[model samples]
Target: MAQEPLLRCSGMDKSFAGVPALRDVHMSVAAGEVRALIGQNGAGKSTLIKVLTGVYRRDAGQVEFAGNPVDFTSTQDAQRNGLATIYQEVNLVPYRSVAENICIGRARRRFGLIDWKAVNAEARERLAALDVHVDVTRPLVEYPIATQQMTAIARALSFDAKLVIMDEPTSSLAEREVATLLDVIRRLRDEGVAIVFVSHRLDELYAVCDTITVLRDGRTVADSPISELSRYDLVSTMLGRELTESERRGQHVGATATAAAPTVLEARDLRRAPVLNGSSVTLRRGEVVGLAGLLGSGRSETARALFGADPVTDGEIHRDGEPVRFASPQEAIRARIGFNSEDRKGEGIIPDLSVRENITLALLPRLLRRGIVDRGRQQEIVDRFIRRLDIKLAGPDQKISELSGGNQQKVLLARWLCTDPEVLILDEPTRGIDVGAKQEIQNLVRELADDGLSVLLISSELEELITDCDRVVVLRDGATVAELEGEDISEKSMLHAMAEGTAATGSRQPSGSREEDEVHD
Candidate 1:
């Protein structure tokens, strides 16, 4: 007879604010296996992990562990049951020593007093067993983020955890650090531990996971062996699209265009202490220039500094051959520069406002006369963009939050476009949206550039950057490491520049290395 699975969850259902985040999702993990949970943003991947780790209670589901039903009312209860979760943010006390952080609740003790010496020694030994080295005596914050992440993993393994749930564990890790984590995962799997790995990095999922489960719109779309799937097929399944030649052709429509115009925006020696080095790049009219790099590579920081969302300590910004300094986003806007922030919910949109209101937000002054908005003119402009962008909404009066992520993004694009800006800076524009919406957004970007608008595109998806950009500027360790254009924008080229930081530019190499560099870069 076959052995029962180590963990099995059936009919898991969860909702947030009347919206079903996870619906009847079924998943199972066998001992000594690594399973990947993947989907677009808002596809319920995070929700499933939260439910599994008791971060959120499922509205409906049956959780069976080791062939027996179980109920966990809290994360502590779940951890006590041999289940542990390591979040992307690394949820451990940074001020505490590594040993204390790892074995806080179950510290070694003697006669009701903490055994500090034994705890530190044991913690160091445990980490060494996992092939991770760290100074257990020092505070956790003293080490790099990658080391902190490994400590979290070591702590989970120390629990004798039957199943370990990793939620984007490599999100902030460097290429080398990722390899270490992957090695640790393999060791744990060989030792009969089940792992559920959640990540947006398709390549990492293929590397570490033996089986794949894809979620879409709160439902399980497929659960199959990784060997039975191709990357394109996996992306299509997660995106709810049928595999076809036309769809693939339309995936990267912006890359074919070449820039043949004067520069719209240029940054010379842009620098911010500790984060952004003396980096420089130029954006020309009717072209999409991509800022490519891993997290903390100064891509977002450059955008912020250029848009005056953040102060710059050094460097100069030139518009049409003249130096310009923006003291605030308002100044940037007035100068015809628009920035679409990466954090949509937190920074991009006003959820309580209506779609019409949000779409015309940047142009409210234009619609105002004597401190009063012209409702008819506002409605006209909103209606035009709503139709032009194919923004799916019940009506103009619908709340911005009520729309899908794709529609919210379209609203944001309209919010800036209505202002008639010359330059648009989009950070992760297609993030967390469905496949259809992603293509539409990409095509819209191409159309916008063709219509003479300069764009600065920053995305973690390297494929998106390569295909949508007229030229790619690679950054590493807060500096411009390499710039690729025309024939040099292939995936291999970008990967090389990002990984080695030696792309014919003779730039300084990155000092720290981690796994996330591979995925994000």
Candidate 2:
């Protein structure tokens, strides 16, 4: 008879505070197979991992491991039962020796005292099996991040783990290190160990995963062998739509005829150390410019540099055709440049504060008189913005945390709009919100731009950029590859420019362009 599969989970369900995170998700893995778990942010990938690892309790479902049903109450129990995990951040003690990190929990004992020599020898042998040769006696911190990750894998195997769950293990590793880690994973798989790989990098997933599973909004949408899916299909599956001609039409939302408009802000060789390499962008009076590129392509860096959040050490910046230097964000704001950060939960909102307080944060100095807050004026301005933005909330005094993701974002936008800045930079503004909220925000952006607001929109969604921006500046490896304008705004062309890392300045107007006069898609 065939041997039973190593791990299987059927009808798994989990929720937090009545919000369903995972719904009837079914998954399985053989002894030596590599399974990829992928989804957008807040799509229940993390919750699924936690349920499997006992970091969370399942509200309903069944999880079977090694031919028997299991419900682990703690992570330690799960680890002891042969399921091991390695997180993006290595969890080993920094001061401990490499050998200790590997065999610290499973050390050989002698004479009622832990034996160090045997542990080091065992660690050395374990690493040697994976073709890693490192001094096991040295402190873990002294070694590079790649070596530390290898040590973590060794530790997991030391438990004789049947399944290894690697959660973004190479998120912070250098390219060379990533290659080495992939080799190690292959080696482990050859030894009959099942692996669960979770990451946002599609290239890496295609490289290592044998089977791919995609999750969308807490449901398992697609599960198939890697060979069956192309990169475009994978992206479409994850995003929940194929780009048809219907979706392409009426996508452009920003100003189309801005040829006569003058530049409001200009970046001449904007640079912030190694992240940005003499990148230049121009913001006109009534147009939206999209910053397009893959992850780590310096999209956010460009925004930060423009807003003076990051120091512009080697660039010339001008506002309203006049050259100026802004050493801090305050100076940028004073010069009428506003920025809405990508990390809304971390940098955009203070959860403990109320809606009114968060909305009026940037307008404080203007609303202050004799070192006192002008409550009536503050109320008038806050009420006006709240109504204008249609921010859904219990009351102006409601805790900002009580509001949904979209409302919190609206509050941030209000904070900037109240300032009446000449230019606004929005980075991933609709990332984790619902579909309704995303559309609302998109409409609002178009309305604002029509009223002569200069916007710099940075989003991972190509359609969003193509739909909203009059032009897109493609960046690759910290440098500008191409600038698409007029009829040149299309995903095919942008991907070409990004993949080639070269400028495609052809006048090929896409079929969907509102105007047939120009070419560029």
Candidate 3:
């Protein structure tokens, strides 16, 4: 007979403020199974995970764990009952020692005293099982991100957890680190631990998961063995439509730049310590230039340096043929340069503020009169951008936090557009949003560029860069090694440039003008 599933949730329903997050969702993971839970942002993946881990109570459902009906009151309660979660960000105290973080709740005690030696030994044993060797006595912050992630995994297993849920565990990890984490997960599955892995990376799902469950809107849409699902079908199921080839490849707004185009912004030999070595980029008027690189290749660092959010150790920035230095973001804004950061939640929005406030944030200085905000002018600007961007919000007075991820991103974009920037730098502008929203943002970006606004685009997704950018610059080891423009830009050429710098024969050499090179498609 088949073994009973390790975890089973049937007819699970959850809502917040009368808005249903999950509707009759069902998921099951058998012992020794590796299951993938995937969906776009605001798709109830988080809600279901919260309910399972006791972060929230389900409005209606039947949940059984280990052949027993369970409703955990808290994460601690769930951990004690053999369920553990490792969030995308490592949650342990940074200043705490690795050993202490691992054996935090269940520290070894002897004679009413904490047993330090036993604690360290146990932590080492747990880490060694995952092939991670580290100085357990050292603070967690001293270690790399991969080590810290392993520490989180060790802490989860230290509770003798039967079911482990990893939420975007590899989002912050490099390629090799991802492989190592996947190996550790496989080892855990072999040891009969059921795993529920949550990630947006489709490659990771195919790599580690045996079964898959797809959630769309607020309901479970697909549940099947991972091997049985094609990548195209899986994406179609999650998106509720068979994406056209044009949509999948990204549809460009037919606009191209010529050699006669004026140079708007130029960064030469930018250096900012360890992350950025010697990066250089040139943006032309009415052109979208893509910055492509692997993780840790200094894509975001370059953006920060350009925006004056971070100072560069060396380099010069020329705006419209005039050399300029911005001491801070305010100065950059004054220079008519707008930056949309990749970290949307942390750096983009003030969650407590209203949509109108967020949309007009960067323009507040211009709207100030007698040291007071000009509410009339603010509303005018906010209303105009809201209508232009088509941001879906109940009202301008609604809290920015209440909006979905896509709408919130649109608000951020609006914040920059209101400034009437000469050049806009977008770092992963469409990340973490739904497919439709992503397409909307991409189209908006193209429209903005076509309007003669110079744009510097940075994205990890190559297809996005290919379709949206007029030219692509490949960054490796903190330097721009190759440039692909016009018809030369392709997945193969970009990948070659990224892997082996300057290997792509289509790579364009530095020149005073691109007159000879005209965009074909």
Best by TM-score: 2
Residues forming the 10-long window of minimal summed lDDT in candidate 2 = 510-519
Tens digits of per-residue lDDT for model 2, 52-118: 9999999999999999999988878998999998987999999999998998767899997889889
| lDDT score for candidate 3 against the true structure | 0.85
User: lDDT per model, in order?
Assistant: 0.83, 0.82, 0.85
lDDT leader: 3
Q: Considering lDDT, which of the candidate structures 1 and 2 is the better prediction for this target? A: 1
- lDDT of each residue in 255-336, candidate 3, tens digit only: 4533469898898878765556568889998889999876556789898888889898888898889998788999899999
lDDT-based ranking: 3, 1, 2
TM-score against truth, every candidate: 0.67, 0.80, 0.68
Off by over 4 Å in 2: 1-4, 128-139, 251-254, 259-282, 291-328, 365-384, 390-399, 402-406, 431-440, 459-466, 472-521
Candidate order by TM-score, decreasing, is 2, 3, 1
Off-target runs (Cα >4 Å) in candidate 1 are 245-259, 265-283, 287-336, 349-420, 427-451, 456-521
Error of 2 at 123 (Å): 3.4
- Predicted candidate 1 versus true structure: per-residue lDDT over 1-521, tens digit per residue: 04578999999999989989999999899999999988766789888887887789889989998888987788888888899999989999999999998899999899999999999998999889887777898999999988999899889878889999999887777667878888888988888899999876655777889998989899999998987876646655765655332321123344554455888999877877656766678899888989987555678999999999998888899988899989999999999999999999999999999999999988998898999999999988999999999999999999999999999999999999999999999999999899999999998998999888999999877678766888888886666767777666755555556545546333323332232433322
